[model samples]
Each structure stands twice: as structure tokens, then as C-alpha cells.
Target: MHLPPISLMLLQVLALHTLVFCCQASTFTDQTDKQALLEFQSNLSPNSRVSLASWNESFDLCNWTGVTCARKHKRVSGLNLSGMKLTGVISPSFLTSVSLSHNSFHGSIPPEVGKLFRLQHLNLSNNVLGGGIPLGLSNCSALLNNLEHEIPSELASLSSLVLLSLRRNALTGKLPASFGNLTSLERLDLAYNRMEGEIHEMLFLGGNAFKGQIPSSLANITSIREFDIAACDMTGSIPLSFGRLHNLEILGFSYNSLGSYSSRDLDFLGSLNNCTQLQHLGVGYNRLGGKMPHAISNLPNRLTYLFLGGNFISGSIPHDIGNLESLQTFKVEQSLLTGELPTSLGMLSRLGRLQLQSNMMSGEIPPSLGNLSMIAELLFYLLYPGLDYNMLHGSIPQELMEARSLVSLNVSYNNLTGDLPREVGKLENLIQLYVSHNQLSGHIPQTLGSCLSLEEISLNRNLFEGSIINIRDLRDLKLLDLSNNNLSGSIPGHLVNLSV
Candidate 1:
């Protein structure tokens, strides 16, 4: 049906009005976006090492460097001002707040960000940005922050923050105690930050450990602190260039196929002396062999943990082992080390755990060990000094019994002989005493009953004679292997807790 002439005129007028309104709105959005882009460039131009000379009003806003605009309305949709080598403060105002991540942008985040009333998303992650995290960011639902320096207690105010990923950074200082106040936070990552806390326990990689031998070029990354490449199933020697990594901390190469039985297998230890901050070295459970180089003694004095166990290491331990004053746990167990205990070991006043079990070490027990316990009574201390399964001979030194901190004493399967020191009773904390399969011959110390914490008492296959001394007070006793001993008296009735 045909409309009347006046109806047609009304329809035509309405269509023209809609077109003009859309054109005016589009022009406004375009001009606003262009102005915002120009403002952002002006703030960066003076400090930016890269050129933004192309950002000018003479050209279209869409064509300006790192600027993206909507095809329909010609309004800025994105601004990737990354890698501009920007050196000034972050721009306070921007038309879009999405995807400004992984740039070379430097400077403090502007606090004026809270002024963006219409803002929804903001991600300034993976940049050279340093300074306290901006407080205004608490308003966002998610964050991929890249901040350096110490974290401020003020960040606990971001109660609504969900994901805060700040991994692989140089952030230092203790974490603010107030972070527990983040009631709405879901995930928080602060890996690789040099703060005062345990960074990780075991970082098990889901995929194959190595692409191959770790690239020696990685040594060029002198700033790296950790090299925990254990269980990587990799072959070849560690790169000597690793010494160049002056900031290296924990270096782990355990459970791998590194090092031949060659003399130079552990030459890398010499180079590692340069890493003054080195601590917690673990090269255990590998195919590494040969005598430990004297360079091992030259390791950084800062070293606290040295795990050279489960290898084919032979020859006497370096005499200068005491040089590592901060040494805490020395585990060379299950190796082929021989020779007497280095008397200098008493110098490691801070030594806590000495595990030399399962080696070929011989010679009478060192008397200087008494000094370890004496100094321990002052400041540094030790516990669980395992020397089992060796060629260690002569009497159990009376001084060794003074290590009151000893909880477990295992000297089993050795040539150890002589009376069990009555001083053994002084180890009130002693739990398991395994002196079985040795030449030890004497009445089991009646004072052993004083160690109420005693659990497993394995004195079997020794020449211990007369009678089993009173151990009725050992209520926690579990395994009592006294077989093949010459004890003549009947077992006490109260010894019901122990399994024969």
C-alpha cells in the first residue's frame, strides 16, 4: 500500500536526523581519543629513548605509533606504547587500559589511576617498572603486576584483588605482614625474589628437564641466582662459565648424568668460589666420580649446605673442609671417601648435621669432636652425626658422647671396639643406637636407661657380655636386636615394650 505524501516526508526527515546524530557522536569519540594519545606521547617524549616523532595532530590518530583505533567510530581501541624505552612516570590518563604489558616502560605507576572512573581492566605487567605498587590498583578485579623494590603494607588494602602475578623479579625485603588481610585474593606468585624466606622446596618440571646440556651461554646471564636442574636427565659437565654468575645462590645438579669419573669432573667447584652468595649445593645421586678436587675446599665460605652424596667420590676429604665456617649439613654419605676424620672439622662450630655414613673412612674416632659439642653448648650445635658402615675403629671416644644434641647414633658395621662409653647416657635426646655388627664388647651401659627417649637399640652381633643392663625406663623402645651377644641374665619383665 502506498503512503500519503505527508507520511513519506516525515519518514525521510527522521532518517536524515539519525544519520547526522551518529556522525556527530563518532566525531566526538575520535577527537577525544586523538587528544588522549597526544597527551600520552607528550609525557613520554622527553624521557623516552625511542622516537615518537610520528605522533602528531597533522596525522590521523590511528596512524600514530603504537595506537589502534576502531574501524567504525575511529576511536582508540588500544595503545601499545611498549618498548618505547620510556623512562618517565606512567601516563595518568588513557582512553584504553587493556594490554600495556611486557614493555620496556620504566617509571613509577601514577596514583592518579584511581581517577579513571570508567576504567575496568589494567595490566602493566612485565616491564622495567619499579616503585611501590600503586594503591589505586586495589579497585581492579585482577592484576598482573611487575613491581620491584619492597612491597608496601598498603597493598594489603587491595582486598578485592584476585590474581597477583609478580614472578621472576628482583624484589627484596620482608613481605609485609599485612598481606594476610587480602581476603579476596586467589593467587599470589613472588618466585625468584630475593626476600628473606623459603622461595621454593622442589620445583618439579612437568616436562623433560633439559633441551640438552644446559647452554653454556646461560652463564652470560650473570644475574641468575638459582640453578636447580636436578632430575633433568641431562649429560655433560657443568659449564665452567657458570662462575661468571656472581649472583648464583642455590646450585643443584642432583639426580642426573653429569660428570665422568675424570679428575676434572668437580673442577667446577673451584670456579664457584667466586659466587660469594652461594649456598645449598646439591650434586648428589649422579654419575659423578673420581676424587674430590682440593678446589672443593676453596668453595665460598658462605656455603652452608654441601650434598655430595650418592656418587663415586673417593680419596680423603680435603683437610681445609673447616674453611666453610657456615657449613650446616655436610652429606658425603654413600661415597668412597677414606682416611681419618679431619680434626679441623671441630672448627665448624656452626655445623649442625654431619652425615658421613656408608664410606670407607678409617682411623679412631676424632677426640676433637668433643670440641664440637663444647662450642655447641655456647652457640653452634649438631645432631644426628651418622658415621655408620665405615672402617672407623678403636673405642667410641668418650668426648663424642658429650654431643647432647645427638638424637640418633649409628656406628653399625664397622671395626669399632672397646666399652660403650658410660657418657652415652648424657645423650638424653638419643633415640636410636645402632652399634651392631662391630667388635664392641662390654656390658650395655646401665646409664643407657637414663635416655628415656631411646627407641631402637640394636647392639646385636657384638661381644657385649654379662647381662643386658636395665633399659626398663625406655617406654618408647621399639626394636631391641640384642641377638648374638653374650648377655647371660634373663630379659627384664618390664622390657615388654621392646620387640626382640
Candidate 2:
């Protein structure tokens, strides 16, 4: 009941009015965002089947299905429309951590997607989406994860991104040079796309993918591993600087246009000796030539897999190859290698698979091969041009049959003689056998039929004389090739009962 001074009372009234306006303004902003999102929801195809009823004035966005609100309750944090069979362009007004994967969304990604400033994760994979990647995606400053198509150069602006998966899309165009700017990226997968051009040095983070001259500049990102740049048409020899990547492991350069390597070609490979952690090196189907580097035998002791198939590798396999104690897989198929297989190969105690098919390797199969008891299969395409040049003589070593772990053996097209070893039945896990086109004589080992697990057997072009016997033991046989042999009897009647 005491009256205040005029100026003071007016000031108080103005202060209250200001507070009310601020509250109204805040409410208006929230409603505007809601309306924008609702408008977007309405534009979606009826097939989308996403109901906006859950997104109303009373219900909190965090409580809505496929919607997540920020901790501050100031805005929606996430929006997932995956698997909705959506068939429309994305709405630009909706700014949320969005996921529209596994949908039918088609058309070019809208540049407006870049407006989602607070977005952290955006997944639009497994859709019929086409067109160049939107340059605006770089605007998502908080982006930590992205699975989009047609990767945009603007994406390099996202300094906070961590994981990016862009696989299995029709994306084309060279990878933007700005990709090197994504310093925080970890799991980058761009497989099964049309990305071309040599990887820039900036993108080659040592142990990480990006073949060619090893990006000496990126050698500092030692945390990188599992680098894959396969099927990218990359040419030129591997950079020797890669050896600087001490923590590097699992490098893949398959299905590229790379040239054959020589001793000079292996300078990069030799440098890899410094990568003590290197494992699973794949350079298959490249043009790598020349005798393999002798130093290749001294690669990281931790090596478990080495694939150099489909190349022009010449010369004899280095005798020191046995030094790779940890090698589990060694493949040099389709090369021009000559001379006998090194007896030292027997020292590879951990070797599980050995493939030297389609090579010019000559001389008797080393008896030392029996040491590879862990070898599950041995594949070789024997090339014999008469008895003069490379006639692989001597009987098939009984020691080879001692490889009880052998599941499949392919030794076709050579001057191999003598009867098929009965010890072959000891391969309990044998599933496939190919001994065709050899001069092997005598009756086909009856014990071979005892291999119940055998799925296929190729004894064609051999002098396997004598009548066939019980084939019922080969219950699992899918195919049996006894054609071109000198066997004297009709096909065994019991073979009629097999699934083959």
C-alpha cells in the first residue's frame, strides 16, 4: 500500500515485460523447430509409415521413437528413419543426428543436409540414393560418424568425425584431396565404389591405406592400421617409406594395375622390415615382377598372411623363406618362378596354406614338405613340356601323405609317376583331390574310396588300371572324374547310390 516513485515503478514494469517477452520468444523458437520437423514428416511418402503423432507439444522428443533430444532439452539430438522404405528427398529443415539407412530414399543428397550444425551421426547407406555427395555436409561440425554416398570434398571440414562407412554404393569420382583433413577419422571404408586416382601423400597415413609413395608426411599417425585401397587402379611400386610405419599392419593392394617388382621393386618391401607389427600383406593380382627380394624372408616375425598372387614374380623362391616363423598363409600363384622349391619351406611350422600354382618351378617336390603338417591344402598347376625341360621325376613322396591335416590337394599336369599313395586315405578331412594328367600307373588306390568326406576326386589322364570297387564309402562325393584313365572295369555300380 506504499506507492513507489514513478520512474522506479515504470522500470519494474518494463523489467517484468521484458522477462515475459523473452519467455514467449523462447517458446516460439521451440514451436518453430517442431513445426519445421512436422512439416518434414508430412512430406514423406505414405509408404514411409512414420507417424508424427508421437512428436507432439506435450511429449518430449527424447521419449519419441526414432527421435532423441539433446541433454539441454533445447533441440532434437537424433532422428532415425532407417528401414522405413522412404522414397523422397531429405528435408533440409530437420536438423538432427539422422539415420535414413536401409530405406528406398533416392535422388541426389541435398546440399541442405549441411545445415544440420549439431548433427553427430548421419547414415544414409543401403539406399537407392545417387548423385554427387553434397558439399554442405562439412557444416555438421559435431559430426562423429557418417555413412553417406558420393563422398563430398566439403566433408573434410568436419574436424570431429571419427568413423565413415561409404561402401557398396554407386559412388564415382576421385576422392577429394581434402580427405586428408579428416585427421580424427578412424574406420574409413570406401570399398565397392568408383573412386580413382593415385592416393595423395596427405591421405597415406603410414600403416594406414593409400598406397603409392608412402605419405612420409602421414607417418606420424601411427595409430592407423587395416588400410585397404584395393580395386582402385593404383599403379607404381610401393613406397619404401612405408617401413617407417612401425605399427603398420594389414596392408591390402589387391586388384590394382601395379607393375611387377624386381629386386629393385622390393626396396619398398624390404623397408617394411621396420614394420615389425606388419601382418596380412596382400598384393595379389598386381603386375609385381622380378625374383622376390631375399630380405622378404626377414619380414616381421609376426607376419601371419602374405598374398602375392597373379603377378609376374620370377626367379626361385628364396631359400630363407623358412625364416618367417609366424607365416600362416604364403601364396605366389600365377608367377614365373623357376627352379626347385626350397627345402627350407619345411621350417614354416605355422603355415596353413601354400599355393604356388601356375608357376615354372621345377625339380622334385621336396621331401621336407612333410614338415608342414598344418597345411590344410596344397594347390599347384603342374606344367610339364615333355621329359626334357622340367620332368618332375621320382615317386610322390609318401611323406606328403603324412600331412594328416591336408583337406585338399591339387597337383595336375606334370610327369608324376607311380601308383596313387594309399596313405591318402589317412587324410580324414580330405574334401577335394586333383591328381589328373599325370603318368601315375597301377590301380587307383582302393583306400581312396574310404574317404567319406571327399567331395571331389579327379584321377583323369592317369594309368589307374584295374576294376573299380565299392564306391558306397564315398557317401559325400559330389563329383568323381575317372575319365581318360586306363582302368579296365565298368564304372562301379555302388557309385550310383552316391549323391555325386
Candidate 3:
């Protein structure tokens, strides 16, 4: 078709313009977002291994390292620079998920981080980040850090928060009562902080300076499963209201000043029996005194670890304690406990570590303890089936020698009278044997030399008659005290030349 020259020229120009516009659209990138990232890179210390050399105006930010962008808008969506040895200030950006954990980022978290209204997950954990947590993180579903400073009450606004961990920080001051407003909160860990004052449920504030009674308000959080406030300065009795937490599994309030020698001090044990699922209960290293209530036997049968040690608890350990069929660790050392060792303790098939040391316990060592075939890791490899410092007077139970896991045995300073058990040599794992200051009579058992692992043997001040025999093979022996015994013979040449 014939057309004018002007019309042909106009059509050609229109085609050229369309080509140029499409090229520009294809190369379009969010310059603002790119600039923000560049600014962030500038704040970090230079590292040849993890440089942001690709983050420049010449390239698209979506193609940069540790950065993600939306397909349509090209805005930053995620930034994961974790474990890159990043050392710098974290510049605020409009991101959905930000993870700078396991880095070397230092200094206070900028409050401008709250400006990311779309932020859902933020993790700055395992970093050197310091200062208070920004109040602006209320929109985050998961916020973790090593932040120092009081827990901001503004966090109560984080209704979407499911996990908040600020462990190993210097956070101090009381938790605001507004924390109760966080009904959606599932896990809150503020451990190893300097936090003081009361606390509620879903709290793991162990290794803190928190003092005063465990707040009764904790009973309101019925969904709480694990609660630990150990190694704190908290005083006063455990609240009776704790019984309401029927779902509680692990409860630790150790190393505190929570009780005295009064009966009312341990009444909480009776209340705790209501928690049927209770498993691990550690109230050790406290001022808990008075007779251990028999109700302790009624604690949920699911209990595995029971640490009530380092207290002033007196009187007999309840015979019914054997009812805890699931029991693993039973530690109650350094107390004023009296009465015979309960034979019922042997019924605990899962019993591993049984510590009843430094007490005034009388009577013979229960032979049934040998029935604990499952006993392993005894007292952390220093098993002191302590009948020591007591009036216990009987032969060392041959049954105890059945425990092949026995490492250290301390029957020292007792009124025990008998020949050393020949079966003692069967304990190849025996490291230290302390039967000194006892009325043990009979020639030192030649079988003792079979203990290849023996490092220290304290048979001093006993009626050991015969000269030590065959101990020359114990090259690991460092300390051997057979002094003040009825031994009349030339010292073995090996013993005289021994290093110790």
C-alpha cells in the first residue's frame, strides 16, 4: 500500500521508542533498597573472605549475597548473613526475615529495627550485640538476642510472639506485669541475666539475681511446661499455688534460700503432687530444712531427676521413696539425715546416682543397693555411697561390689567392723577406696591389688593385720595410707621405693 514518507518515518520512530522503553523496564531495580544495603555493607569491617563486592549500583540487589527480594516489587524480603563473621552495625531495612546470628555484630540494637513493620522473624543470637532490646520488635514472631538491659514492658505488645530468647545477657530489673498480656507466648528464656524481682510462667530465668518469693501469678499460666529459676537468690517458700500448673514437666528452683527447719516450709511438696506429669524437680543447694515430707514419695511417678541435696533436711528418708519407679538420680547429700539406709531405695530399677553423704545415717549399708544394675555414671564418676561420718556398723555389703560401675567408695570415719570384701577387687573400675578411721579388722585383702585403676587407698587407723601384699602392680596408685595398722613386717621393697 502506498503511504506518505512522513507516515513511514512516524511508524519507524514509534517502533524504536517501544524498543528503548522495554529495555529500561527490563533493567529497572529498586535503587533505594540497593543503597540501603550498600550503606549496611559500609558499616561492616573489611573482610576479604566475606566482602560485599557485588553489592553496587551496577547490579540488582536481589542478586546480592544474603539478600532476597520480592518478584513483583523487587523490595528486600529476607537478609540472612548468619555466621559470615560479620562485624558491624546492622542497618535497619524493610525486610520480612532478618537473621544475623552467629556473627560478630556489636553495639546496641538500633530502635529503627522496629521500622520494619513487616518483620516476622529476627534472630541476632550468638552475636556480641549489646544494649537493651528495642521496644519496636513487638511485631516480630521470634526475637532472640544477647541483649543487655531490662526486658522492655513494650514487648507485651508482641501478640504474635511465640518464642523470645535473650539468654546469657545482663538484663536486669523486674519483668513487667504486662507480660501476662502475651497470651500467645509459648517459650520465654531470659536465663543467665541479672534480672531481679518476681516472674510468671513460661520463664527460664535461671542463673539470675532474682530474689523474693516465686510469684503466685505463675499459677495462672496453665500451659507452662518447663520452669527453671535455679541459681538465683530467691527466698521464701515455693508457692502452694504451683499445684495448679498440672502440665508442668520440669521445675528447678535450686540454690536459693527458700525454707528453714519448720514443717510449713515443705508443705508445697504436698501441693506439687497434683502435677501428674512432673518429671525433673531440682530444689537442691537451698536452705530447705525440716524432715523430708513423706509426700515426696507421692510426687508424680513420672519423676526421673530428684536433687534435694546441700540442705539441712533431717530425719529418715521416707521408705515410700521406692515408689518412684522411674527414678534415676536421687541426691540428698550434706544434710542432717538420720536413721537406717532404706532398703526400699533398691527398688528403683532406674537408679543411677544415689548420694546420701555427710549425714548421721546409722545402720548397715543396704545390701539391696547392689540390685541397681542400671546404676551408671555414679555421682559423676566419684560415687560416695557414703556410709561415712556416721554410726553405720556392719560389714561392707558384698552386694555393693556387684555394681561394676562403682568408681569411688567412701565408708571412712564409720564404726564399720569387718574384713574388706574380697569381691571389692572385682570392681576393676574402682579408683579411690576410703575405709580409713573404721574398726575394720582382718588382713588387708590381697584381692585389693587387682584394682588396676586404684589411685588412692585410705585404709589407715584400721586393724589391718597382714603386710600389704601384691600392690606393686598398681602403678597408678598415687596415695596409699596403711599407717596406724597392725602390720609387723619389712615394708615391701616396691612400697619403699614407690613414688607416693
Candidate topping lDDT: 3
- In candidate 3, what are the lDDT values of residues 378-490, reduced to their tens digit? 53323336556777888898998887777778888889998999998888888889999999999888999999999999999999897777798898899998899998778
Judging by TM-score, tell me the better candidate of 2 and 3.
3
Higher-scoring candidate on TM-score, 1 or 2: 2
Off by over 4 Å in 3: 1-44, 51-84, 92-98, 139-146, 197-203, 374-384, 473-475, 495-500
Cα deviation of 459 in candidate 1 (Å)?
0.8
Error of 2 at 380 (Å): 22
Candidate 2: tens digits of C-alpha lDDT, residues 50-97: 444676668865666677655664655467767766666555534435
User: For model 2, which pairs clash?
Assistant: 259-287, 260-287, 260-288, 260-289, 261-288, 261-289
Q: After superposition, how far is residue 336 of candidate 2 from its true place, in Å?
A: 2.7
What TM-score quantifies how close candidate 3 is to the native fold?
Answer: 0.80
lDDT scores in order: 0.71, 0.66, 0.77
Ranking by TM-score: 3, 2, 1
TM-score of each: 0.61, 0.73, 0.80
Q: Is candidate 1 or candidate 3 better by TM-score?
A: 3
The clash numbers for all candidates, in the given order, read 0, 6, 0
